[model samples]
Target: MIAKRLVIAGVGIAAVLGGTAVVLDQVTAGQSADSRSAPVAGSSPTASGSGADPGTADAATAAEAGGAATAEATGAAAKPAEGSASAPAGREVLPAVSPSPSGLPMPPPPAPLISLPLPATASAQGKIVDGFPADVIAFPEGTVVVSTGVSSAEGSLQISADAIAASSQASVVGHFQQILGPLKFWSEPVQAAEGQQSMRFSRGNDSVTLTTSTTGTGSTRFMLLANLHAAAGG
Candidate 1:
């Protein structure tokens, strides 16, 4: 007989195994779990693993899967679900695989983030992006605002700034930092071109992304993205 113990995220106390629904006790972040059940006894044993009866094979498979889950739920990085019984107890839970309407596994929720890499750089001699300027600069054409347009259901706010001039990636980023004081940078601006770079910044749920590029027309382009919804920890 095999006893199955499982560790899971808060409010996620069960799992689907071999078409069977197995319920485990709720576990707190970093807490031990209590969920064990002996597998169904199989038919007469065979020569080896290859000849094991279907029941025995199923049991062994489930046991291995359960063990892996236990390891994940017991990790230090596990976050607790909100409003759970363990909330007051300082227990965290990690997101777990959820079943979709088709009975298939759904992807876990996205973690909060600030930004990603830069978009393509076009013409440097173009109109200026408005409403979000870290500082004033001389651009032959002007600056325009743009964003990567991250998708979100809760809606989002965008504040962008762009420029069309000659400027180094570092200088543009430095200027933005001056305007957005008290901001926390998540990643350094990675230069995609001699005059183009992208970086991520955050303050709680608020996020600021800076992207700069040079257009083929001898222009410098800069954009600043500020999303309030994302800042709220989307």
Candidate 2:
């Protein structure tokens, strides 16, 4: 009885071991087949993680990572450059300052131009003199008479000539003094050359002036002024 029992138990043990081996072989075969059919690394990913193959999930993960990297690259390319973002659109940048061509600082603008005024063509007093004691001075013969008119109204007269003689000037002065003779005519001293003289004489309501000066070529210039005020209530 003991021997039979031992033989049966041994057979049962063998059967169990054989079945376990077969089960293990089948599981290994199934795993190999699944591996062969599984998605490769770097393939598209699945939406779901549950029950997903590690290889497939890994491929999906790698693909996602690569896509993110590619997206980053593309965005970097599209983004504006550092200075471009700050620059104004459609406008060119100009230099803040321009240098002088001479390389020195630009000269201050030229000082405002100014000019002196010239005298008018005609004399200011309008040649107002007359009855000039030609006896006092006379122009040299043939001296060009550029102008030959004297003007007077009331008690004033002026005369001018382009050329004259000093001797004639002295003679005329002596004659005038002799003719004026001593009538209480108050006189005002006036500066004059040796042969030329100016005097103003006043007597109550009457006054007279004898004035003279000479310029280039001894052009004789003289003025005579006389005022005989009406006697009181006359």
Candidate 3:
């Protein structure tokens, strides 16, 4: 009986050791499987971390590429628009300026009028017979006045006229001939209607008048006048 009890105890001890070895083997196999599955889970497509989807990453990359392409196209299109905006509009364009013509001659200006006042002098040929007051002699080419004060034989002599027509014709003729030799004078009498004389002389539009009258003793007196309407260019 003692031998059987000892044998039974030894079998119980062997069974317990077998069960412990089986449990340890199973535990080691489970650890190896967990280690293998951990690597697989890390490498698997569906096991991506951070909730990131592969399709979503591809879509984002495509979207970024598309946006870059669109931006490049937009930049290209905007270049011409920016260039056109910087250019002038139709109304803002300036017309071409023409240069002045070379060597063109200008017209001559008109003449200027003249006015001269002369000093008094005596007549060398005549005595103080019938003298008058201040004389105004307007030359054919200019407006000149020869004013003489009241006269005795020794004092200065004055001459009077109704306009310039009653002045001494010989003095006027001599004066004009000396001053205006370039002018053309009428040689014949210029007659108006009703036997009125309208003498005309000109030096570039200058003119003159002449008239004669008989005194009571058959003495004749002549008057001369000039219109200096054209001496305006001097």
Candidate 4:
């Protein structure tokens, strides 16, 4: 009975030691797992930290990618407006015009008429002492005569002729008679030269002495004569 009691006490002491060893091993394993799972206070984890979650890291990476893409799109949208603002302003374009020529049409000139010269014979013998060739006479037979005379204040008359022809007396006398009406003369024809004639006429106190002669022939022939003191003081 004493030996059986001692054996039972030793078995009890062995079972208690085994159980304590098992409990110590379990506590050590739990301490190792806790150290691996928990982060240290006030310490940042590295990229390779065992405490970091893969899912959380992937979500952070996706957020960063989305931010970059948004930035790029914003820049693209603003690029066109910036480019247009920096460009130059537009202008209205027009073509250049030139001047016209100065050359144009103009007007024409005028016509010229015939004029006769004054005589010198009357100026030498008259009181007024100035004379001009008055009328030019032409005959159908081609003769021309230029008459020259002088008149005094006392109604004295001196007449002379520049005969263009010795013939053509009738042609010269006819033309002289035709112009006589305009000269305001009344006269009877009197022979003065071999082929010439003279006429005398008067108006008021004034007297006229005329001498006519032939010159040239045909249409170029004419007669010239003088009427002096026909108009008083004229």
**Better candidate number, 3 or 4, judged by TM-score:** 4
Q: lDDT tens string, model 4, 1-234?
A: 899999999999999999999999999999999998787765447534756666677789999999999999999986776434343457654556787878886533211111223233453321122442234222334323443344433333444444354454555555556765554545576567675567655433333445554434432223233444423434
What are the Cα lDDT values of the candidates? 0.50, 0.53, 0.48, 0.51
Q: Determine the backbone clash count of candidate 3.
A: 8
Task: List, residue by residue over 118-151, the lDDT tens digit for candidate 1.
Answer: 2223222334333222232222323443332323
TM-score of each: 0.31, 0.26, 0.26, 0.29
Pick out the ten consecutive residues of candidate 3 with the lowest summed lDDT. 148-157
Better of 2 and 4 by lDDT: 2
lDDT of 1: 0.50
Task: Please report the TM-score between candidate 2 and the true structure.
Answer: 0.26
lDDT of 2 by residue, 140-225 (tens): 44333333333333333333433233434445444446655454445675776676677766555455566666656655554454
Candidate closest to the true structure, highest TM-score: 1
Off by over 4 Å in 3: 1-47, 80-85, 88-234
Score residue 159 of candidate 1 by CA lDDT.
48
Instruction: Output the number of the lDDT-best candidate.
Output: 2
Q: Order of candidates by lDDT, top first? A: 2, 4, 1, 3
- How high a TM-score does candidate 4 get? 0.29
Which portions of model 1 miss their true places by more than 4 Å?
1-155, 160-162, 183-187, 190-195, 216-218, 230-234
